[model samples]
Target: MLAATKRVAFGAAVMALAVGLAGCSGSGGSEADEGGTKGAPGAKKAPGPENAVRLIGDGSTAFTGAQPNITPPQRLKPGEKPPQFVVFSWDGAGEDSQKLFSHFRQVAKKYDAKMTYFLSAVYLLPEEKARLYDPPKHDIGTSDIGFGDTQGIKDTLRELRAAWHEGSEIGTHFNGHFCGKEGGVGTWSVEEWKSEINQAKSFVENWKTNADLPDEAPLPFDYAKEVVGGRTPCLEGQKNMMAAARTMGFRYDSSGIGNQIWPKKTDGLWDLPLQLVPVPGREFETLSMDYNFMYNQSGTTSGDPDEHEYWGNQMRDGLLQAFDRAYEGNRAPLIIGNHFESWNGGTYMRAVEDTIKTVCVQRDVQCVTFRQLADWLDAQDPATLEKLRGLKVGEAPRAGWPAFTATDTAPADRTEKH
Candidate 1:
């Protein structure tokens, strides 16, 4: 475990800036094998009676039916053990020169896994129209990470359309990558946060006009209804963000830090936070993220060439350890965050890919998006969830899975809507 002092210091440093599957096998079967009634990514239609697709503002997005490729969650039967859940989310997700956004979409398909992509609003807004963004405390056209180029915006739109069809959740990362105390998200009020959130949706809901790509196909889902939650930039302003979000119908927020334990609702939103995992051979732990690994390993994005491999392996091992603790012990969901960056020779990216390949194929594991996890959480009985939350990090029920979750009350007729 990380000492309190070091954890605070390290978290602050990492947050000061740093903007950025499975089916084939296993005892429980891959997510693809679990429920893949929908056709391939681009072929599946949204679920609806008429299955009509009405275009929203400027035809940037459409009111497609329910998202495809996602299976509605079921309540755990009496004395049943929970399946291990792992969420691999990307921050500032956009397809740029690196092509990582599209690359990972293919990777998820191959592994039979699904993920969450926290799309930064600026990614869909072309650089030429940067002035369109009205960040809370920053000047007009001011963005710490800047806006994407024309082609980058188009490529990102294509990926967003396909990713949703493939069952991945598209959450917001808000607009502008502001951090620290001065004019950062932390200082923004709830109203300001609401404004930021609205703008984020606006950029996506009207990307066709904003980016001048009238010929591009409309995004498959409505941004207003599709986006159920998000992580604040640098994980700041979550308190205010959640306050603003809940009233706007958000179901969860992933902008806090926690240990390996089942989540609980806070302020009416499921608080799915990044966890503190071991840093390989080190005594202290760091947040389960790529930038923290880079910060602790070399304190620079361009670290020693020889140490890149070691650093990558260290991060991979640390995440695996975190997964193992929850998979084999408490059955808590593992929340991991990353940026679409190639810092440290793209070592962290490689590490993430390796981790996905390793864990997504394991028996009884489900690599799903935050929204999916929230749906599962919602299906559980409140008392059952309270009991599950009683277990400490990495501490399994001494009575065993069946005996521990055993309930005498009649089960609730709960059903999840993907």
Candidate 2:
């Protein structure tokens, strides 16, 4: 039954087309980072420090008490079937004219979901400060995705502040959105990747100094400690990127490809890659992302207006089918990726919003961020995770869960100190 669904979800032709499109461009970040910064500049003072806030780095970010709206993971009881975990993560997150970042924040709140937002550092760095960003293998101030205007930066800051306070995780999508053979991230050396990562962090840590937005409230969490993982632009450079991430104390990487099954560690970090999910009315799987569906369906970002509704339904149904397979069969965590763009006449955005509303409220469903997922994965017994890893895609244990985990017992919760 699961195999049949998989076949119907993705067609061979569709998969081939998506693969080709992926190589050409990706949905995470735009391919236009090659322009100078152009915007008026004036820094606003960061919000006055409160009792809970400890100002850090030119008052751009602060260390507050434990993040609100976050709960420690509880170990699974013996012989218990795992609850379905669904992670809705966005790459290159920023609030632009479309206001998708803020829009989704409200949507997540309505659905009782917590998400990960992979913030591109360039979004916070104003256009005037573009030269401050030294992207590896790219000219200074040269960004394939361009720099943010002052108003855009301010809007992004507001959302980032609110989102973190509301329990969302803020991860980095690195600096530039460079792809392809000519100075693409894939060609960057380990040292170059490290430089990019540092610059990304530096921009977040010193936004006040660079943007001169002193009056705005400092970002609520210590970005240095709060950021635990991120997805790479275009999902490239995982090999060296993972090496850099581990050394830099990152806990996970969500930039690879995988089937709808249990995740495991790679290069000392949780390898929570984007999954292959069903695409309704198709016979081959595509990555669980809005852009992949858009590419496969329209063959362009903006296709025929009349087909938008059908395309949206196809994506929604595909994700739902993928969720059911895990919920009923293997119970692997579902990781879905999206961007802030409104591709295919905003149909993909609508599809994603619909998917979140439908799945997040289901019984035994926990909508969490990658950081939360990693913490939960870490808290589990290694033996139990190993057993879970043994289950193939959509393959449940021959014995029922109770018998399958008969010897297992819930371990004491190991809560981390804030």
C-alpha lDDT (0 to 100) for residue 44 of candidate 1: 79
Query: Per-residue CA lDDT of candidate 2, range 1-418, in tens?
Result: 0000000112213345244223211111111111222445764434543334588979998887677789999787787888899999998888777778888999998999999999988777777888998888878988777777667777888888888878889998887788766788889999998999989999999888887888877887888888889888777788999888899879999989889878999868999998888777777788988878877787777699999999999999999988888887778999999987777889988999999999999999999999999999888878888878777677666656776655643322211111
Error of 1 at 18 (Å): 16
- How well does candidate 1 score on lDDT at residue 403? 74
Off by over 4 Å in 1: 1-50, 408-418
**Ten-residue segment with the worst summed lDDT in candidate 1?**
21-30
lDDT digits (tens) for residues 1-418 of candidate 1: 0000101113354432232200000000111211334678788766655566798989999976778889999999988989999999988787776678888888889898899999888878777788998888789987777777777777777788788888999998887767768897889999999999999999999988987889988888889998999988777788999999999879999988888888999988999998888887887788888877887788777889999999999999999999988887878999998876777899999999999999999999999999999999999988998877777777777657777777863223222111
Question: Which residue pairs collide in model 1, if any?
Answer: 21-111, 21-112, 21-113, 22-111, 22-112
Top-scoring candidate (lDDT):
1
